[model samples]
Target: MMPNRRRENAIIGLGVIALAQVRSRKRKNFWIKNCLLNHDEECPMPLLPELQENNPDDFRNYLHMTDACFHQLFALLSPYIKKRDTCMRTAIPAEQRLIATLRYLATGRSLQDLKSTTGISPQALGLIIPETCSAIIQVLQKDYIPFPSNPQQWQDVAAQFQHQWDFPNCGGAIAGKHIRIVPPPNSGSDYLNYKGFCSIVMLAVVSATYEFLFLDVGKNGCNSDGGAIMQTEFYKRLQNGSLNLPPAEENVEGLNFVFVADEAFALGENILKPFPMRNLTPEQRIYNYRLSRARRVVENAFGIFSSRFRLFLTPINLAVYKLNHVVLCCCILHNFLLRNSSSYLASVSTDEDPAVSGPAEEAASRPSVGVMTGLEPGHAELPSQDAHDIQQKYLEYFVGKGAVPWQEIVADYLI
Candidate 1:
């Protein structure tokens, strides 16, 4: 009986050893599979946290905004983009999503590059950016870029133009910028511009403070500025006297108030363009200079905008409508920064092109014909009898009673 019991014990021991060996083999196989599938044992920590914690300058450089700005943005976006947790997996934090989107806008980095810097998968970003852009436009448009609803609001804008730019009765500066983008599937040269690239036009009316009062976007690259303006609802309303612009003020005796533009835009009662072709009169030249001075606000505004949001410098790889949303999102953010931050202008000069941020340096540069307002050529026609008379009246003022002290000095220099 003792011999039989000893033999049973030995068999039980061997069974236990075999079970242990099997479990060890399974553990080894699991690790090996994971190592093959993923290069590291766990995903690396995101780049933003480390920079934000240790190196602040790099953080601001990477995001193109201060930490306070980031917090402000996160607060604004949280209500719309915040995610709910579930049993199976945790949702990404709203802060993480905003950082990812801003990183894209600030750098215009490609998806693969962003994945490396941001640690967000390209697949996730593809969904996040467009949605975030849509949310920005949806949330910020009303308060940030609301059109002038009353005569007082319009007068307020004109007053700023007079105070800052020395131009009277000017509601806003109107211009356009080409937002480059890849061609959509099955699209022809409809997006091609004279510069030989695919683009969409962003025509905006800028206030004296460089805030965009109104925006018209999504026109094809081939659409001239004149055509784009003609197609807008703003144009229709202004033409029909429904835009609530202030009653024509006498900035100069009988001349009416108007928005200034380059010769690219068709002249109208509310729109003021410079005299076409070179003329012999000192007054016309002075009028052009003053008009150009006011108009440079839009150019500088675009320069600062493009410099602040580097996305405009790069061709966007989105559908046409998605591209429009992204541009609108950037414009709103620009205005938000202007409204909230006092140091933005000073800071932008250090980073952006001085031409846009430096209004003083722009004094010497005359408004040349066919300048870069994203307007196509061959669209402007001779001003109507009324439009020509308005231009004449303003010309008389610039060289006459309402003239600036330096108008003739600068006009003579130009001559």
Candidate 2:
């Protein structure tokens, strides 16, 4: 009986060995089929020629190149970001995340698609996008993007305005644009209006070179530009004399010599507006025309931003917080490009021709009068007498200064 038991045990052991060998062989076969072999083993996969590949779609192309652009942008932004605990822990290594977000914004690609193409996990991608945008905005608002700091810079900018667009002593052009955003998760359909759906207001300031200097975001889509401005820290600074501004005598065009907005903004002592009244005198018409020519810089800047970051042109389906980051990131990239001349600015034309293919055409098409949509209706309606009074003030100011006639400058550029 003992000999019989031993023989049975040996037989069982042999059967187990046979089963293990079979499983090992199956695993090897699987690896071979999937081409997972090391260099010692030949891979039997076929190689395809590069030219034979199909042209990449816009999304793919954006993902491919944005990887590089974001890297450089983040490197410039890293030091300031590292200071914050939240930024340090969760920050999307600036280059990778920022580029990815820009690619998404520029192309309006799905987050899943971006994850697949960029190899960034969807969850990480989501977190990185907003964090990077916030970081970029902080960097731009703090260090890189300047807001007419000294009298010299303001004078230089004003000179550019006079020389390039024909308006003299203009500090910058200011305008407001509504960036379309997804309604809050629980909001009713009535909240979404004729502009499709939107959430934030972009109140931007553009330099004479058409560079975006200040981009303030996150105001409710329901709010007016004036409301947004009133609520901003920058506006508060302006109100409190924290922002060092040139004196009233140096005021160019009108309102303390600061070229602010056209009819969209309310006319004030510090902010310039076009001929406010319907019947304009010859001098007021010239000032209005010249101011229109100069103020187009901000309009062109917005146009360029929207056109290049096509995401702004479309409805953003991200969370409200994420949408704010997206807007800021786009603005940072816009300024970075303007400063470095390697980004979108290189492709833009500086020629005075209104027929240019990019932002110039968009700027030309925007209305010269009336309030921009997404504002409170009564907020923009200026009193006619006040408008006339403002116009008279500007005419008196311009004539007193003996500045070159605005029409000559406009004619030079238009011709």
Candidate 3:
């Protein structure tokens, strides 16, 4: 009985070996026919497909990929980022640092809260936020902002404004916004420079398509818009006559094509403003209406910028010097989104006219363009005669040219 049991076990082992040999032979034959012998034929063995679905929308849904998106953005921007050797030696990996920083910006979570979510320590998070912001600003200042390089580019931008917003020969819309920041350490009266809480000033120009044409950061909130504009590099260029803007054409009432701002910016002949009147003439009203309609591009641009950065939506707890870097980075990303069609502006309802009231009441109400409000802090009011003269001149020019009526223009182009 013992011999029979041993023999049975041996037979079973032999059967297992025989089955393994058969399977091996089959696999070998399959490989030879499909992969080796038929070299010209496509391999039958399944290959892993490349993952091509890493888009911003999809990546934004997942935490890891969201992290990766920031990583990729920072990686592309590495060369522009500057850091001290001491900081660099102790710094975390660039990719990790960037993702963590962006996560903070996007979510507005506390640094302690971010530790669990981003898997970074609180101390590392604090350092990474400022460092990464600095790097982003350097990259953006170097690469992204579109300061018109030539007369032709400026003309092209003007043409776009004319076609899209019916503001013919206009350069861009100028405006200023406050960016909240962390109060500086030992800041007393200096903190008073920022309004409400710690904050900085951002002055920007928005193009016809509601994209940021130029943005400058680091002005204290207490500075008047006029003061900030005077300090801007763009303004410096204009003052130095480095920009090749043509002299105002006689037909356009000798108004050189340039960005029109509120009364906050001191106007020479080039930058035009409407007559400041408690009441305006029909033609003056129409001209102001058109100008206001066109200038809404800047407000919309700021709305989009704030929505994207969300960090600007709330006060940040960072030093004033670091605040400048943060503002710069946000503006750079704003331009990138505009260029790439990845920004909130690209997805917004461009059809809605910000100047118009309710569309539902349109049938009952004549379309009335809203009036321009206060000038930037510390700017002189426009004289009524000068405003009326400018208005009449522009209106007559538009009427003579049979330019699209503001209402028709809004209906056809804006909607």
What is candidate 2's lDDT per residue for 219-302, written digit by digit as tens?
Answer: 776666666676787677766876566665665543555656766566654567775556666666656655676777776677
Candidate 1, 1-415: lDDT as tens digits: 9999999999999999999998777444342333222322233435567777898778788888877777787777799998897974456667777888998998888987886655566777888999998888888889889679888888788888877777888889988877888889888998888889988888999998889999988988888778778888888988898988766643436468799988779988789987765655777788887887788778777877887888887788988877888888998988988887665676332211223534344444433332233667546676689988888888877777777666665555555
Question: What is the C-alpha lDDT profile of model 3 across 220-271, one tens digit per residue?
Answer: 6677778788889988988788877655562245645757776566654446
- The whole-model C-alpha lDDT of candidate 2 against the native structure comes to 0.61
**Order the candidates by TM-score, highest first — what do you get?**
1, 3, 2
> What TM-score would each prediction reach against the true structure?
0.83, 0.68, 0.70
Query: How many clashes show up per model?
Result: 0, 6, 2
Against the reference, the lDDT scores of all candidates come to: 0.77, 0.61, 0.62
Candidate with best lDDT: 1
Off by over 4 Å in 3: 1-58, 61-75, 78-91, 191-195, 249-254, 352-376, 381-392, 406-415
Relative to the unseen true structure, what is the Cα RMSD of model 2? 11.5
Return the clash pairs for model 3, or none.
182-318, 275-387
